[model samples]
Target: MDDQSPPRKGCCSLRCGLALLLHFCNVSMMSQRACLSLTMVAMVNATDAQGLPNASTQEPPGDLRNPVYNWSPKIQGLILSSITYGMLVAQVPVGYLSGIYPIKNMVGSGLLLSSLLSLLLPLAAGAGASLVLACRVAQGLSQGTVLVAQHTVWTRWAPPAERGRLTSMSLSGLMLGPSVALFATGHICQALGWPVVFYIFGACGCALSLSWFVLFYDDPKDHPCISLGEKELITASLPEQVGSGGKSVPIKAVLTSLPVWAISLSCFAYSWTNHIMFLYLPTFISYRLRVDVRENGLLSALPHLCSWLLSILAGHAADGLLARKRLSLIAIRKLFTTLGLLLPALLVMGLLYLGSGFRGTLSLLTLTSATLGFCTAGMMINPLDIAPRYYGFLKGLTILIGMTGGLTSSTLAGIILNQDPVSSWFKIFFLMAAINVTSLVFYLIFAKAEIQDWATEKQHTRL
Candidate 1:
């Protein structure tokens, strides 16, 4: 029987019609999912002050201004950090949820909730600390949800050869979100009050949530818009991916991995130095260095900007190393991890010793910011290495442990400074610098990208 030979006319017509219908359905689903994903990305990227036009504007004359100094400076910095504190609490739960649930739905829900919270910020800001903190917490909850879930989505969509570049791009959004927020917030706040910042974020969030519902699909097999070849390439390249296998990742096994612990510790160390510089730098500049709010915002943003640029470069380098097989993953990770931790440690100490009047402080600060990119090659990619199957849960563990650094640094800054802000910065930097170097040594000793034989054996059996 010649299968390709012309069938009876009526039967042939029916078969062609069925094929056309299926193709149409697939294309429609894919198109919708792509739009949804892009919208969610925009919502996640745009919610910060960087996206607002009014973030840096002068306050109303009657609004609370510190009698001895400008109060706007304190309000802006503290409020901006408030949401992050909430995020610290939400990170682990969100990560766990990503592993157990449909990541797309989790992300969509977060964007929707966060957008709603963004709309409420201006009202809450006017109300008082209690309301403001509540709104900030809401935003944090949403942010944490989006952050973890999006990574899970990428593990499905992206390929192994492209994972480094894609991971860099995805993680870079954190940098990019703030950069855009600051730029937009500066202009908007100049023209309008701070309330406009909330309004813009809210609107974007709403739009993104709707788009995600319409556009996003959970896997390559589910994506309607992708071609057969593209889908094959993506799934083929995906390792023991989270959703595809329909089996739970053994959490206990992952926790026992020495490499996982090393990655977590290294991440914590890095976040300690980085978060302090981020949360308190504005206060430090305003109080200790005598910089105005406008100038301080721009300067405070430079480090993240540099980190974003360098992360892009680092991604390309990682890909190059893998493509050429020029070095073991250990060598690549070791070089970047060493530089990442060591350079920042030295620069941090330099910042402390140099003091407020030093001529090179700004230059050193910029260098400190740039050095953070070095860690991207190591800590950022570690999840894919140890458990490509459980990227969401594993990466979540890194983030959860790493996030504690923020709390520790904040508490340290508070206790050491006696809440004075200006007097304690140097002490804080010195301690964190020591911590970074110590962690770097341990990381160099223990961290490895290659999965052990047991992991390989388990994956082989799964096949």
Candidate 2:
């Protein structure tokens, strides 16, 4: 199939508008991660008016406490950890369902659930850490389902030639969400209490979820406003099996595919390294760089802004290369994947070795993250490359594998920094560099962009 030819005709403008749907979805759900982190920072340094622990005291704040001064670090960790656990448990089932059912409904419900849960976070915390953990877990489960289902849904909507551009544009919300969340949440914390963080994000989620149901459709065939020409263009451009493959799944073939493993392993590595930045970078800056808490959000958002802009450019570049037939799909995917992981790995080491002043260090880290953004053009688009029919399922598998980065990387950091996290920054940076290198090796050896035979061959479909 000619996956990279110019469009024969323009699709409905609404088709383009549909990208904004996921764009908003990405922004709303992804914001929660950074928002909660910002809130945690506030709570950690908070002390009561009387110098006791109290969440209610702004005049004389107290540390995060059960009553007025007794919150345990262990409990804090538990509340955060539950979300990861929820994501791990629900991803497979959600992925499976998205492929067979109406993905719009699944994704919409997930968003709605997560938004509602966000509203309850402050209440859950008031009840105690265990209750808070449960709420976070619920949020995680919903988010996992919604995010994994995205490629599956996009598979139906995106033409093969433009997949990278469209996907990246939607995924750009990932970058924008945290960038805004950190800064906005920080400022909001100063003016209002921490609970407002949840309320604000929750409101955004609620609004976007409503927009999704109204604007989104499962397939081009189902869109009420699609013109005949656009509908034909979309349907003909799509791989045949996408509409048909869900009825039968080749479990063993998919599970054992070398490309799948390569993608999964690479995802694991990327997630591990990125999770360090996502979850711990703010903490690291506060303790090691001696940044003030109020400014942490704005500073932390810098890398994300760099990443967001770079990813947009990378996506257009990848699509342009394919459209011009300047490179084979496999070569394009491989080259960019290498660029994404390889440069970041090396630059991160440079960041560690240079020990440049704060500005220089931030510049290097920004460049490294910008390099990582190229993965938006590479592995992030691979499931659509190989398995349009089962794209969601494959995406779910990779994400499930990738999320271990959350548990494993953070746990490693905890162990390595048992004495003092500030002093242990070198170890953390080195570990991230090593992970990036390992993922690059695995990807170079095994990842493939060609459609797997099992995707289209009926004889193997039932396994």
Candidate 3:
């Protein structure tokens, strides 16, 4: 149970294979989520020379061959946030189901549904903004199961010693999705049209779901292709309580736990800033810097790309520190969480003073994203540390609470920008800084890295 023990060899084990697949799963899911951010620039009509919609003037359709709607900033914000609304509704139910069902089925089905939805998005957009919103919400509902199921997968496969690296590697796809999607969406939209973005990403999602069903197994013991040594290593490394036949989740205890709330608050702050960046940074670059779609895509992607790389590195560093016993588990969580939240806040605030210097602005945004990556080692993975048995459910609960920030941030940014797109950014970034500091203080005070008592307590009541 001492997780400080050195990790065994066999980097190519079945669990590692699962981690890779999980990485691709996140990539596919996020690609679906992010493709719209850049695609919308091309999807909308009546844009000025800067490619942003002219706030003063509204125009009708030009070409039906390469169709573009006349959705306002407020409507665009609603479309962007609709997915989170669906996610909020589905997360708790799916999280609970993940614990009771085979994770492979839950995750594969979710991705498949979302892929089918992606293929339909172009048609939805063609019909109207309302239809597009409906499509996004449905896609959100399907993808909602993904992050929760990811936590469930790790509960069965990731050994405590290797948890940091394994989970981080898999979750890095969350950032990588936006990076790849944004970069590719720009060129794809420009060349083939915005609809092609959906078709290509949808095809990729279908392929990934097929691969997942063929290769992924809920438990090592269930995997037919796993080597005996690898299976034994994974099975032995897991806690005895995990995957032991199901017991009722202690809902009251979980809801009342301060540590749970701590994680939730941290997630809220993180999701807020993260959503703002991925969802709107392209608009910001276009509106403020006056860049073309290709340049806008490349610039917007740089931050997420840096964040993805840094997340993988941070995971390795966190595991190494724990292995060497250089820091207590709680200390490591706090350290990384602080670095993740605090630095980004400071950098975001610095953006207030930088007067249109493209390099300075891009550097700050990239550093903000890169530092935010450290949270993958912090509150992001704390559910497994404290409640491995119910991590999926706990993650569901926290994400439900946390993703509200995504909804709020996107909608609020839309409302604020609706007032004045250029001058109002100061309000958005300042709000982000304040929320980050407040959440960090709460998390540092209440977050725990040890197993909770209720997590181990057995309850005979069945769900």
CA lDDT scores, all candidates in order: 0.61, 0.76, 0.85
Q: Any residue pairs clashing in model 3, and if so which? A: none
- The segments of candidate 1 whose C-alpha lies over 4 angstroms from its true place after superposition are 1-85, 242-249, 355-359, 419-423, 453-463
Q: Per-residue lDDT of 1-463 in model 3, one digit per residue for the tens? A: 2333343454666688788888988998999999888887777742732336544343335544457776876688788889999999988887887888888888899999999999999888878989989999998888998877778888878888888899899999999999999889888877887888999999999999999999998878777877666667878877553642367888888888999999999999999999899798988887768888888889988999999998888888999999999999999999989998999999999888766688888898889887899999999999888888788888898898889987899888878888776678999999999999999999999999998888875644344
| Per-candidate total of colliding backbone pairs | 23, 9, 0
**Using lDDT as the measure, which candidate wins?**
3
Show the colliding residue pairs in model 2. 46-62, 46-63, 47-61, 47-62, 48-60, 48-61, 48-62, 53-68, 53-69
Tell me how far the alpha carbon of residue 12 in candidate 1 is from the true structure, in angstroms, after superposition. 37
Q: Candidate 1, residues 194-226: lDDT per residue as tens digits?
A: 456567756765775776676677776775654
lDDT of 1: 0.61
Task: Estimate candidate 2's alpha-carbon lDDT, on a 0 to 1 scale.
Answer: 0.76
Query: Model 3 has how many clashing residue pairs?
Result: 0
- Candidate 2 residue lDDT tens string, 98-213: 77888789889999999999999877767766787888988989998888877676677777877887788888777777777887887787777678888999998999999899
